[model samples]
Target: MAPTESNKRLALAIIDFLGSSLKDGTLTADDAESIEIAQSCIADTFKVDPTDEAAVKEAVGGQSLASIYSVYEKLRSKSTPQAGSASTEQSQTDKPKTGAPTAESDKFKSEGNALMSRKDYNGAIAQYTKALEIAPGNPIYLSNRAAAFSASSQHEKAAEDAELAVSVDSKYSKAWSRLGLARFDMGDYHAAKEAYEKGIEAEGNGGSDAMKRGLETSSRKIEEASRGTEPPSEELDSAPGASRGGGGMPDLSALAGMLGGGGGGGGMPDLGSMMSNPMFANMAQNLMGNPDMLNNLMGNPRLRQMAENFGQGGGMPDMSSLMSDPNIADMARNMMGGGAGGAGGAGQGGQGGQGQ
Candidate 1:
């Protein structure tokens, strides 16, 4: 059979490609001599000049020979062998098998990850779905798809995929973390907390910092719901003396003075009246118990100065200064209940009673 014009052109293109590989350093200096020799041999056999720009262009047909060969390889890999007559091998080749990642499935997963990096959640989902089709019970694929779903704000679908992933492999900590995040986004705090706990258990070495933080946040939310308190907003708009529109810190000016324990009169004020206010009492007790809160308080130079002033009977610490510390501000918002009481009169009378 005579070689077709296209086949001749293809051979020319191969020779041209080999020359290019050497020039472009694709073939290292060590292999340059061998590559040049191979290119000359191919050009001689094909009766083509690989260095002839016009001939090379015509042979390449606007696309590189490497690209064309890549297409050929892909098609060959996907092609299944046919049998003259039906046989067990033929039947098995036709039969669809699913489970575990194959090379083909892994390629899809890599594509999905690339799409995810580009924030193409829909495209990533499609690629992940293709991978899952080839490997149905793959926890990693399911977890990746779940992350894509979550990124797209499809919380329900994300939760479902995450749950399936965890069910397939309970020890998959990332899957459990995804499940917890999905639940948390859906406002299912208790469920989120449980999932985070499971994730922590799955991670033998005390779990990742992110997982532990998620667990703490979920637990805080559950506690807030039970205590009928709203989580602190990003901006603490309801500080002391701010108009009480459903939420605000109570006036702590007098309580601050009492904490200082009266100076000129020289005696500690009776704390009975101050402790009677549930908001004040609860906050005081919680603040005293919280090591983090105490540490933050003691670490702040301004706060420590205010505390010293109170001890020297310096009256109320400046509300503005006290609220400036974000830790104290958040604590005040989270612990303070919506209640009002006359602490000024209480402080004065308690001071008098103690002085007598």
Candidate 2:
């Protein structure tokens, strides 16, 4: 029999998951032979040759892969396909089904991500809700929605989505990172640490390094919390484009919105989108590697008050005014280019840390 619509979808979802995971170093195998079957099957199912990356991308609609096995595994666990009776097929063809969730859900997911990039988090959440209404337990939708919730500072809700993402696919490394981050932000340091540990083991250093750093941050947070002391100010939060993460350091993709930066167009800053720069990543790494470096850099009289302001959650200092002290400005410039702590690669997955 020709491939049915259901079979095509299954093949597509599997390809979306496997192709992306294998390419991104997230699912690296020591030997290529391991995934040869997966590669060949996806290509065969799509009627494309195994060697054509372009063809693979085209078939998957140029969308990034989330979890390959998430939906498929659920189908396996839940119910088996029932062969449609001739009468049922005729009736279905005669009367089109209404409100059946399908590719439209993917479009909703894309819309939600765009809103998230624009920092329209509430709007993003709404879009994600619509997607969920269609493909309820799809891990990709759950994880995307989870990211938006975390961005909006709703760690509890974010944790719920992230939790569901992992439950849908235990091998989903990104979901585990999301879970660790959400738990960290909720002040459940113990749980956060545990989750990160699992995430690190599953995804390895390449894709989920953020979970490892999160493990470290949680350990520190737990120690400090036990003593009834607030965690120290984060070095990463003090630099330009710097944002905060649970008081460890500021990761200001959000603050970047609040800060004054003008792109060619007059739109609200793309805080979330702008954070993809390596500069932000590098600054975070340096500070995390040598915690003392921040103390030394901020020792200058000019930065002391500004650092204090961030620590207190006072509205950010005026950039022009802060830069008026050229010495301070020079110091700030130097700091951004400062030592590498080898602390990069733990992207948004490490952003949650029980805000102080």
User: Model 2 lDDT vs. the true structure?
Assistant: 0.62
The list of candidate 1 runs beyond 4 A from truth reads 1-97, 229-356
Candidate 2 stretches with Cα past 4 Å from truth are 1-101, 205-207, 229-356
Tens-digit lDDT track for model 2 on 155-193? 999988887777666667788788888998898999888
Best by TM-score: 1
User: Which 10 consecutive positions of candidate 2 have the poorest summed lDDT?
Assistant: 347-356
**Cα error, candidate 2, residue 132 (Å):** 1.1
Query: Candidate 1 lDDT, tens digit per residue, 215-250?
Result: 999999998898777555566543322122233333
TM-score computed on alpha carbons, candidate 2: 0.38
Clashes of each: 0, 11
Give the 10-residue window scoring lowest on summed lDDT in candidate 1: 240-249
Query: TM-scores of all models?
Result: 0.41, 0.38
> Which one wins on lDDT?
1
